[model samples]
Target: MLPAPLSEPQIRTGTAAAAPAAAAKVAPDAAATAPAAKTSAAPAKAPPAKAPAAAPAAAATSAAAASDAQPGLRPTTRRQWALAGILVALAVIGLTTIVVGLARWIAGLEPIAAFIAQYPGTYELPEGAPIGLPAWLNWSHFFNLLLIALIIRSGLQVRGERKPPAYFTSKRTGQKVSITVWLHTSLDVLWIVNGLVFVVLLFATGQWMRIVPTSWEVFPHAISAGLQYATLNWPLEDGWVNYNSLQQLAYFVTVFIAAPLAIVTGARMSGWWPKGADRLNRAYPIEWARAVHFPTMLYFSAFIIVHVLLVFTTGALRNLNHMFAAKPDDDWLGFLFFAGAMLVVAAAMVAARPALLSPIASRFGTVSAR
Candidate 1:
């Protein structure tokens, strides 16, 4: 009976109390979520800022490292290089002609009389001592020797021009083909020996870099050389412009490219290449290597013709004098020594006629140049 007295009013009050408890639970949840959102948002922003800053710093460090590894490197001593170059040229003038003269004298199939006739008998050629003598009497002896080297070098450079020495086919093949090849290559060794003297003199004399072109060569490099016209002719360009800018480029390229190729190919033909075929093959494919090598010789032979023609057309005898003579004034004497010795080598060439000198000339007519 007492409990019943509580009835409607008591029931309402109890429900209201339950509502307040639910509201309290909801309030706590909202407060907890607010702090989490604030903290998480702040950490996210911090990470982005820090990431951007660190990225640039890392990028800068990497860039600096790259520059050091590139080939944009500076030279060691420019003045020394200039001096060395000049001395080499001087040495070439003094040494090349003399060797060619002596080789010619011994070869003996020369057209000239006094040149080859001077030495008709064989005088056991001293091994290391100057290979040819008498006609190679003066300092010009050295020059003539150098000329033979250049000729051999030039001869070796023609494209598909001559067959490679078959000495390495086997011992038997070597006996048949190698003796001459060995003899010919021996000249290169001899030439290199003499070249050492100049290598020393380059530093000793101090005249190397002037002969080499400078950095301004870049301007010429950018220009379209094909546009340049040739009015006069070779050796004597259009006028004061002896070698056109284009011609200069060609000359420089020859000095740098063709000559270097000849050297590499020659080295390949020598013993060094067989052991290191991988390196040589990079420049040319295996099948095409010999094809490319021999053809280059022919190509260089064409260059010689162009060069000789240019010299003669431009100032022939004078240029020859400058190249062969000891003193500029001494070209005449130098020419005699060179030409005379060449006659003897020419005789030897005719007798040997390795077919390398002129396969076509033999069929068409008898003609050979030492």
Candidate 2:
């Protein structure tokens, strides 16, 4: 049944009375639902947390894949290069053999045979030419061999070294250099001094005429000698009395041309060059020295190889006697001397290591590892 509307004060009183009851009814339901809400939210947050952990793992996987794809240089490449070198050597040997056979066949011709007979691979030395190798020449030759070998070894070290084992600071100018360079320069100085003495003695003893060509006929004779050597039927000659035309020419070029070139180029590249002389530097650039120096080294290397081969093949005993014993006989004395000299050279090479060289280097300069 409809009842009369309550006054405004009664209505407010009723709402006020109902408010706590409504809150009480809702409180338990909200409490029970709060845990569910937290659980759901925790799952949502977990994915994001786990995402950061996955990133590092993914990055490591990608790095491993990249490394597998682009593996650096392999040892097989080095082996391939070695194989190529062997093939080239074989090709050169084959070609040389073919050329030698062809040369022998050509020499059998009448015209070539007559030319060979007329020249006989050498011409008579001038009347004033020295008769035999002197004792001084033998000593100088030994020194030259030793010094050049050491120089070459040190020079190679200077070129190939990435980190020098020691440094040298000169006491005079306070200029610093690598130990290899210092050794190379020192050897160069000694070699030059020896060369100067050799030149002085060569001229003093009238031995200059032996190596120096006195006539224009030397060209034809040298050609004849080359042909004979190429045919492997080398001409018979006594080196003590007179060198063949080819030998004389080789000596002349080595002494006069190659030696001077090496010295000039080496000086240009060395610390001895006056850095203040811009004009000289411009005229003879360092590039020129670099270009000329390596080729000079190669020439010397080739000369040594061929010289030793000929000395041994042509007449080992007699050649050794001429070189070492300063005599013309084929006795074992020269061979013994040669063996001793070789032993000395080997010992020097072995002692050229940093451990031994450092003490000697410290005498002229302060040596340190930087």
Candidate 3:
């Protein structure tokens, strides 16, 4: 049945025919799979294209975070604050001028003149009152000025310091405080002692009578003197003999009322207060002391400003003599002493840096970086 094996050409033709049929069958399957493959590939390519769009949103978010991190007043807000300050200053100046003008006009009236003539701004002191400032009083004044200035500087430093440059640890008690606080407390102690001495001397020498008002007439006289001052026609310069009614009252308030209040409030806030005494602490809370202490400082500042301004304006030479030289004459000696005292104050202020203070502080206690 072999019929003589098939020729080569016929065999080739048969295989070729089978191959085409197989190819036709496979073409349909490939067509179907191509669509699905392309769909999957399309999504993958689309993600890369969309990636750039998200980048801008991410950048915007980062920028917003950065802005929030740095907090500060806006330029417009700062400008507004500057403008407000300027307006307030102008308003104050305008008000002061108006008041002075009005006071001047009122003081020119005949009735006011007669009233001024009656009071003359000062009443006679008690017969036993001291006539002039003593040498001890002048020395006390100088020391008081020096100590007060230093105390104020240290106090301000303590209030503003977030990171203290140095700390002071008590040698015996092992309590620690900022160097600024230590200096402030130390100056306060010295000032208190000096004040005590001044008070003792003032009473012992009968100098208190000059500052302490003894008559109801002082009120009207003080009002008259204030009016005179407002009008730029100040009361007579007679501090060497006796202060004006207003001056007397001011001194009395400063020495008696303000100083005691400052001391009490300061003590309440200071570390010197017994920490174990919860009952005392509850009775006079530290918060109350804090509230009062700042206002007391402000009062002292105002008093110093007004006192210095009046001393310079009313009669510089005579007042300087009365305060510094313990004399009534208007000579250059008092001015020289005042200048020297001021130089000392300036030197002390300049030398109050941590570098200089640390060594001195270490003498009494251990000084360390905070």
**Best candidate, lDDT-wise?**
2
What stretches of model 2 exceed 4 Å from their correct place? Answer: 1-72, 76-89
Tens digits of per-residue lDDT for model 1, 1-370: 5555566646766786787699878977776778766645633343333544675787788778886676466464888788989999989976756655654454444443343233221112112322111221234334434455455653443333455432312222222233245445545565555544544543343322212333454233323222111212111133111233444555556545665565556666664445546865776655554555566666656766776666566554454454455233423665665577567766655554345534422342333232
How well is each residue in 3-83 modelled by candidate 2, as lDDT tens digits? 999997579768867987998899778768787766455332433446457768977998888878877632458888999
Cα lDDT tens digits, model 3, 275-313, are 789899899999999999888888888999999999899
What are the runs in model 1 whose C-alpha is more than 4 Å off?
Answer: 1-177, 191-211, 217-229, 233-251, 271-285, 328-338, 351-370
Better of 1 and 3 by TM-score: 3
User: For candidate 1, what is the lDDT?
Assistant: 0.47
Q: Candidate 3 at 225: error in angstroms?
A: 1.0
Which ten residues in a row are the worst by lDDT in model 3?
A: 39-48
Global lDDT of each candidate:
0.47, 0.90, 0.88
In candidate 1, how many Å is residue 22 off? 99
Q: What TM-score, to 2 decimals, does candidate 2 have?
A: 0.80
Poorest 10 consecutive residues by lDDT, candidate 1: 227-236
Q: State in Å the error of residue 156, model 2.
A: 0.9
Query: What shift in Å separates residue 221 of candidate 3 from its native position after superposition?
Result: 1.2
lDDT of 2 at 205: 95
